[model samples]
Target: MKKFFKLVGFASFIGILYYGFITYPKLDLISGFSAKSIASGHFIDHRSMEMIEKGDNDIKMIDLATNTIDENGQFATASVYGLKERKAIYREGLGATLIDADFDISAPYEVPKRTKLVSDKLFPYGNQEAKDTVFSSVDYAKLNAAVSNAFDSTDKKDKRTRSVIVIHKDRIIAEKYDTGFDKDSKILGWSMTKSITATIFGILEKQGKYDIYKPAPIVEWQKDKRKNITTNDLLHMNSGLEWEENYSTICDATKMLFQAENMGRVQLEKPSVFEPNTHWNYSSGTTNLLSYILRNQFKTHQEYLDFWYSALIDKIGMKSMVVETDMAGNFVGSSYSWATTRDWSKFGLLYLHKGNWNGEQLFDAGWAEYVAGPTKGSKGDYGAHFWLNAGGKFPDVPRDMFYCSGFQGQMVAIIPSMDLVIVRMGLKENPEFDFNGFLRGVIGSLKR
Candidate 1:
C-alpha cells in the first residue's frame, strides 16, 4: 500500500509538469485556431461541417478538439480534451469574433451603409458577366492550360486550391474554383489581411490625414525606448518590437489573437529589442498596433469602424469582405478577413491600376511606389506591407514583382512589367506546388 501511494504521487507530479509546460499553450492554440476557424467557416463562408473539418480543422493538434456549434446562439466552441475552452461568436456584417466574458455579444453592432456601385457594365469592373474578347497577345490555349494545370497537382502537397483568378489589363483572363466553392464564395485570406490594412493607411496617406514617417502614436511608447519607432518601421516589419510568430504553438501572436481582450493593445507592452528600422522581424502584433493607432485617428469609435468599409473596401467593389474584429471590437488587422477570390483580385486590380478604379482615383500613385520599394533591412525581400521578388525569390519572375502573401499559399502576385495580377488561394504551400514554375507558365502564356 505504501509503494502504490508513492508511485501515484510521482505520476501526479509528472502530469502537473506536463500540463503546465506543454499542454496549456498547445491546447490554447488548438482550441483557439479551431474555434475561430469553425465559427468563420460556418457563418461567414457558409461551409458545411464536412468541408470545414476536412479543410481547416483537420490539422493534427486542432483535430484533437471537440467542437460544439450553437447555431441558434450563433457561436462555436472548441475544447481540447476538455482542458482549454475557446469560443467564437458570429455577428452580422462584422463576421466572426472570438469572445470571452469581457466581450459583449448582445451589444448593438452597426455596419456602414454601402454606396451603390455601377455594376451594369461587364466584369473586371462590374458584376455583369465578362465579355468574351480576344486579346492579340494572349495565347488562349496556353492560358487555359495553365489554369487547368493548377487544379490538378502532381505533387503530394494536396494543392487544395479553392480559387485562382488571372487579370491582365484590368480584365479577368482566366478564373477557376474547386468543388463546393464558386465565384461568390467568401474565402479567408489569412495574413493577406495585412496588405488590406496597409491599403487603408495608403488612402489616409493620400488624403494627408496620416503620415507614415511619423512615430507611431502609442501613448505608452511616448516616453520609452520605443518612442522613436515610426509607422514606416512597422509597415516594413522592422518596428523592432519583440515578437514570436510561431503558429504551431502558443506565442505572442496566438496569445494576442486568441487570449487577449484587446489585440491592438497587446504589442504596446512589448519592450523594445532593437532600434526602429534597424532589424527586420516579421510580426502580426505590429500590424494590430497600427490598427490601434488608426482607432485614435477619429473622434468617435463609430466613425473609425465605418471608415474601413466606406472609404476603401465597399468603396471599391469588395462587397463580400468581412474583416473580423477582436473581443474589444477593434479590427484584428493582423489577421481574420474574408473575401471572394475575385474581390481579392479586385484588390490586386486596384494596385495594378495604381489605385484608379476604372475612372475614379481612390488613392495617389505615390502610395504604389512606396509599397513596391524594398524595406531598408529586409534584404530586398519585403516592401511596405507587401512581399517583393526584388531578391529573386521567384527566379524567373520579374524583379519588380510584388505581392500580398498569406499562409498556405494564398498569393496575389502583381507584376507591373506584365500588366498582370494573379491571385492563387489554396490550402497547401511550396515544395509540392512549384510556385515559381506555376508563375512562369502563366506569365509565359501571356508574355509579349
Candidate 2:
C-alpha cells in the first residue's frame, strides 16, 4: 500500500509540471504570439506558417454569429469590431482565448474596377536607355561613389540587405544586392502597403467606382451621424475614429491584426475619437478600413487581387508582390505585404517618373501631383499617401526628398532634386540615424 501511494504521487507531480510550464508556454506562444521579424512581419508567427505547410489545420475555429468559421469564431456576436479588452479563460491549455469569437455580417454588396490613368503617373517617366541618350551630358561614376559612401557611413542592423540600386537622371548607374537575395527574392514591405493602398484608391476614384469626396459608404455610418464623414477624411487620417495604434500592449492594432476576423470592420465599429478631418493622428485603423471597403466593392477577394496584379503590379514590371489577407477575407492593407528589394526600387522609379510606365500613362498626371502636393497638416510633406522629404515648417532636412517609410526600418526614399531613389529593409527598432546627414554625404560624394 505504501509503494502504491508513492507511485501515484510521483505521477501527479509530473503531470502538474508538464501542464504548468511546458504546455502552457507553448500554447501561449501560439495564441498570444507577437514578434516583428523579417519572416512574419508583425502578428503572424512561424508556427502558423508551419501549420499551413502541413495542410493548415491550426487556425480552425467556428463563427457562432453566422454559423461559420471563416467569418469569425463560434461565440461571435459581431463580425467586425475594434479591439476592446476581452476577458479570457483557458480551457485545457488552449491559452488566452476570447470570451466570444462570432459577429454579425451585413457584407457590402459592390464591385471594384480600374478607371482611367491619372496624368501625373508620368513623373520621373522615361526608360534608362532613353535617359542615357537625353542626359548624355551628365557623369554617373561620381554619383555611384557618393551613394555607396553614404550607405557605408550609416549603421546596419540586420545585414540582410542583399542589394542597393541608385537611380539618378532616370538611369540605373550603381546596383548591388547581398548574395542570397537577388532581384527575385520578394522582400517584405510592412507599412509601405499603406502607400500602395492609397494608390489603388486613386485608380478606383478615376474609374468612377468610388467617390472620395462624399461621406464614407459604410453601412454603420448610415445608422448614425458618422455618415457625414467623407472618404477623403479617411484617406488623410481625419476619420476622427478612436483607435489605439499601440503595439506593445494588446491595443487596437494588436487586436485587429491578431484577434479580429476583419480588420476594416473593427475600425468601423469604434466610436469617433475626434471630428473627421480636424486632426491627423496617424492610425493604421484608417488603412484597415480602406481594405474593408475594397473587399466589399469586389465580387471576391481574389478578384481584387487580380485587379491589382493586372492594373498595377504587372504594368510596373513588378514580379514580386505578395499581399496577405486576414481570415475574415480582408486584405491586410495597412501591413503584411512583401516585394523584392529591387521591386521596391522599381516602385520608387515609377513615382519618380510621375505615374507613367515605359511611356504608358498609368496614373492621372493631376493625381500624381496631388500625391506629391503639399497638405495642410503635414506642412509641405505627406501628400495623399506618400511622405514628402521636406523639412516642413521646422526644416529638419536640407533637400527636397520624399519617402514611403514602414515599421522596423523599411524605407523607400526618393530625392526628386537629385533624381535618386534609395531602398533599405531590415529588422531594427528606431535607431539613431541622421537621414538628412546621410543624404548630404551622398551628395558630397557625387557632386561635380
Candidate 3:
C-alpha cells in the first residue's frame, strides 16, 4: 500500500513537470514562430517544407514542434505533441498572421495594389539587366575570396550563410547564394523591419506630414507621464516601457506575439519604468507601437496601407517587399517583413545616396544623417532604428557605417565613405559567422 501511494505521487509530479514548465512554454513559443514562419516561407517565399524546415527547426528545442501547410486554405498549423494547436493564415496583401479561436474575419481591410513595372531598364530604375563593368581599383581575386569565406562552414551554424550581395559604387560587384536559394528568393528580414518602418516615418517627415521630436501621438499615453515619450524616443528604443523580451519562455514578448490579438496595445498598456530618453533598451514592442502611431496618422485605413507602397516600396522598385501584420491588422513592423536580396540592396542604396533614387529624392540626406546619428544612452552603438558603428562595434568598419541588423546574422550594411553596401542574409547569427571579420575582408579588398 505504501509503495503504491509513493508511485502514484511520483507519477503526478512528473506529469506536472512536463506539462507546466517544458511543454506549455514551448507550445506558446514555437506555435506562433512555427505557424508564422512556415506560412510565410511556403506562401510568400515559395519554399518547400524540406528547405524551410531545415532552417526553421534548427533552433534549440524549437525542433520539437510539427508544422503542416494548408495550400487550399492558404494557412499553416503548428502543434507540439498534438496539444494547443496554433494556426497562421495567409492573406493576399497582409501576409501571414497567427489566428486565435476568436480571430475575426469580418473586419474590412484595404490593401495597396502593386503597380507592374513596364520598363526594362537596369536596376535602381527598372527591372532590366545591369551591364557588366569592371572597376580598376577593385581586387577581383581578393573580393571573390572574401565573399567565398562566408560559406566555409567550420560548424553547423557556419553552414547557413544562404545569401551574400556586395555593391560598390552602385554596381553589383559580387553576389552568391547557397544551393536551393537564389537572387529571387525572398527571406524574412526579421528585426530589419524596424529600420524599414523608421524609414517610412523619415519619408513622411521629409514631406511635412509628420514630426518626430514631439510627444508620441498615442492617445493612451496622452493623460499620463508616458505622454512625454516622443516618436524619436520610440525609434531610439529608449521609451523605458516595462517589457520582457525573453523568447525561451512565455514572457511578454512571446505572449504578445503568439497569444495577444492587438500587438500594438501590448506596449501601450505597460507602465513606464523610466522617463523617456533616460535609458536605452532594445524592444520589438517599441517598433510595433511606432507602427500603431503610423496607422492613426491617416483618416482612412486604405491611405495608411497605400502610403507604404506608393510612397516608398513600389516607388523604389522593391516589388518583392511585403510587411506582414498581426491579428489587429497592424504591420508587425518590429519583426515580420520579407523581400528578395536584390530588392533589399535597393533599400540600402537609397540611404547610400542619401535617399535619391536615380535622380528623384525619396526622402533626403537629413533623414540619413538622423538615422546614422547615434542615440543617447546607447554608448554610440545605436541610432534611431538603425545600428551604428560610431562606438566602433565593428572595429574594422568605418565610424560612419550604419546598418540594419536582425536575428541570426541578417544584415544590410552601408558605408557611404567606401561607396559600399553589403547585404548578408543567413539562418545563423554572430560567433557562427564573424561579421566584423567579413566586413574587414570585404572593405579591405576594395580601394578608391
Candidate 2 Cα misplacement greater than 4 A, ranges:
1-162, 379-381, 392-399, 429-431, 445-448
Ranking by lDDT: 3, 1, 2
> Better model by lDDT, 1 or 2?
1
> Can you write out model 2's per-residue Cα lDDT over 159-247, one digit (the tens) per residue?
32334666666555566654334555555676888888887877787777888889887888897768888878777776778888876
Q: Model 3, clash count? A: 1
Q: Provide the lowest-lDDT 10-residue window in model 3.
A: 151-160
Give the residue spans of candidate 3 off by over 4 A. 1-20, 106-108, 152-159
How does model 3 fare in lDDT? 0.87
Q: Which candidate has the top score in lDDT?
A: 3
lDDT tens digits, residues 1-448, model 3? 9999999999999999876776675676686678778898999988887667788567775676788998999999888778778889999888989999998766776677787555787875788878886998899888888888887455445548889999988889989987778989998998999999999998999899898999988888889899999998999989988988876667887787788788888888999999888989888888888888999998987788888888888888999999998888888889988999998999999999999988888887899999999888999989999999999988889999999998888999999999999999997777677889888888888985
Best by TM-score: 3
Tell me how far the alpha carbon of residue 357 in candidate 3 is from the true structure, in angstroms, after superposition.
1.1
- Listed in order, each prediction's TM-score against the native is 0.93, 0.68, 0.94
Residue 58 of candidate 1: its Cα lDDT? 69
Which is better, 1 or 2, measured by TM-score? Answer: 1
lDDT, candidate 1, 73-162, per-residue tens? 998999888988889988887788888756667787765555555678777677788887778899978988878777755533366787
Clash count for each candidate, listed in order shown: 0, 45, 1
Measured with C-alpha atoms, the lDDT of residue 278 in candidate 2 is 75
